[model samples]
Target chain A: MTLAAASHGFLSPTGVEIAFVLVGIATLGAALMTVGSRQLVHAALWLVVALGGIAVEYLLLTAEFIAWVQVLIYVGSVVVLLLFGLMLTKAPIGPSPDADSGNRWVALTVAGAAAAALVWVVVDAFRATWIDLDGAAQGSAEAAGRSLFRFWVLPFEALSVLLLAALVGAVALSRRGGGAKGAAETLAPAAREGRL
Target chain B: MHLAYPAVLAVLLFCTGLYGVLARRNAILVLMSVELMLNAVNLNLVAFDVWLRDTLHAGQALTLFTIAVAAAEIGIGLAIVLLVYRNRGSSDIDRLRDLAERPSGPDGAGSADAPRQPQPDTGAEATA
Candidate 1:
């Protein structure tokens, strides 16, 4: 794969490459806005754009099922959950000067260094590697479902169990007077007054 | 497609999420950045799955699992954040520093920690 792909020069780009680059740029920009925006709700909305752009990238890579799943789960539910969280937290609608932490410069330096190192290593290693996105789509729902049931059934079932647990845990955590401490405090007064 | 394209994009996206996670004051915004990071990983998984053409389709399967887990994570995370906000009246990550180490003398340290501890107790009283 490496030897044959080495012949593919960076100068002449394919149509898919062009589309991927364009969408990737959009996704990256949206992601930057998601992190950098001052308004909390705007950040979550930008996250939707970033996630949707990633879905387009998946389609370009010929992974149709994952792309749709990305759209359904990420752009659909997760972003909504974040928006709800923002509203529930009473996040300021207007621009808040304290949106970024005091250590933002430190975070920027660390993230920049990490990005530089990762890009260098990744490009150096996979410079000659190519993904052959021709012929049949690799992640069509049919193919994914077949393999998932045939070989990945156990893990799939396990994931469902995990989801159930998370649902129950979230409900428990968010409910009023649900925590052990809260329950104890509720019972404490009655017990102290000899009501129990 | 050059594998470098997706790989590099993932790298940049992951770093953007890293910065958000570290820099964002709002816990929900941090979760948004975390979503970005997860999506970056999902992009890589789908790219490599197409590249390898594995019979088991491990990469794509793993990607689906990751999405599910991410959903679960966001649900639980938001719940915790709500709980914190209810108790503290704010969801600013920096302000929820009850566990932070004090930099003062032992007597002063106790005094420093004392103020922050009662807020939650008061919250519980109000709720009760």
Candidate 2:
């Protein structure tokens, strides 16, 4: 089996590469659908699909740890938070005229220009670069953790502090309205009613 | 797989997200757009992390940090947007223009820029 694998064509595309292309196309399509969906709920659902596709893309790239993290953080938590935000804001679940403004064309033009520039720069800079998938350091969680704790500890700690601040800020911002305070005050009665 | 394939896909996703950010009026949708862009950046980071064969995997480390920061930012942004929605009746970014400096008016209310003061009880807002 090892001999057969080694004797495989050096220049021909492999199954992994084919799977990568398929997943990439799906992810890109879902991303566009996420932005273009007319219904707010549908947009959120499309976001889930897009995020999940990206997670699969990460897996194909051999970053198993990050792929799972993407699934956990992005697909699980972020989308749920977005749904909570939508509910809290009383956003219409159906099609919303306010989902988009009148500047779609202008925005599309700018986005196209930016994407073109980035692709051109990246292609020009790394045209000759290739990664060896057989290497150990590319995506193993053990190596990632070692490197993270060794040299990137400060930034990692700072990230924790930033998350703490954001927690405080979210609480403060959402606690300002008096009616919500009333709801909190009535929580006991509401719970009692739910018992019935 | 060609690194350009993933890189190109990331760029397309990023561009789509940018369009959403610029074109969407709902604050929550705009936040989702921001998330899309962040995911694109993460894809690029991991791709380059592999391409460079860095023992430290600094790009993946940065991607993790970006994820954490994105989560934090969305939490705070959602809180603010929900507050605005409660105080006013809408979460339109166009309606948030009153966050700019508003001079005082004769009615002891804010200046004409923010024509309505945000009164939480009555939903008559003095602020945007």
Candidate 3:
């Protein structure tokens, strides 16, 4: 019944494919703009489009769990932090003098080579690999959550620690010169002076 | 058709990001490029994982971890960039080339957070 309704909607396979192609193009274009554009805020906004593309791709692949996480973490948190950094540091909201500097040619060459190599390796390796993909393997959100806590506990715990450390570091970095006379001592003055 | 489609896309995104990181002088952009590269890797992982059909959803799990780590990395990375910008007043990576190519004294021995020009006044400063 639900699948019938879904097919009638724009979420059918053909519709989904069309959506994918359109979104994919938009995503790629926005990503290119994100890198190629001069304005900082514009770049960050483009990043939202790029990240949104990946989330949609995940949805297409039936990886619902990962897709929402992408939206939550990258789009919700990371980009906001990026924007915050831009504002806090008082970077020239206008034309940044050093936005594109000396090594563009070299960077382009190296990036092209790397991309070629990566594509070559993938094509060569997966030449004969058949993908038997469907929605069944993706399972439910509850199942994903269970696996995350049950089997992937170690990595999850490690992530928690990493987040904790980042929180501490952010606090220390943003703190006014507290003169705590500890490991944070070396960091405090610079942060207070906003020289950090 | 094949996973190659996504894989190729990943490669292209990664490379563009790499170029941005290397070619762009702004520290913020470099960080943005780094995020792009990481996302490329995530896409490749998830695509392959879906293709493989393994029992554990290992690729999805790993991508989650990567996102977490990337968040932490950006946090610290931005902090350092903010510091450098404050010290040097400019985020141009080349401005620090002097510190690299030659051995300078305390005169050049501050954080890169200082700016080379006078900072413009914000609304608060304008009113004051």
Model 3, B28-81: lDDT tens per residue?
888999999999899888888888775787888888899899989998888777
Q: List candidate 2 segments past 4 Å from native.
A: A1-11, A177-196, B99-128
| Location of the lowest summed lDDT over 10 successive residues in candidate 3 chain B | B119-128
Instruction: Give, for candidate 1 chain A, the lowest lDDT window spanning 10 residues.
Output: A1-10
Q: Chain A: TM-score in each candidate?
A: 0.86, 0.79, 0.76
Candidate 1 per-residue C-alpha lDDT over A74-154 given as tens digits, one digit per residue, 9 for 90 to 100: 889998889888777667799898999999999999999999899878888987788998898888999999999999999
Shift in Å, residue A132, candidate 2: 1.7
Winner on TM-score between 1 and 3 is: 1
Per-candidate local distance difference test: 0.85, 0.78, 0.73
> Interface RMSDs of all predictions?
4.9, 5.2, 5.8
Residue lDDT tens for model 2, B12-126: 7888899999988889989999999999999999998887778778899998999999999889988877666655556878766655654566555545433444334234232
Ranking according to DockQ, highest score first: 1, 2, 3
Which residue pairs does candidate 2 place in steric collision?
Answer: B116-B125, B116-B126, B117-B125, B117-B126, B118-B125, B118-B126, B118-B127
TM-score of candidate 2 to 2 decimals: 0.82
lDDT of 3 at A76: 99
What is the descending lDDT order?
Answer: 1, 2, 3
* Span of 10 residues, lowest total lDDT, candidate 2 chain A: A1-10
Q: Distance (Å) between predicted and true CA of A113, model 1?
A: 0.3
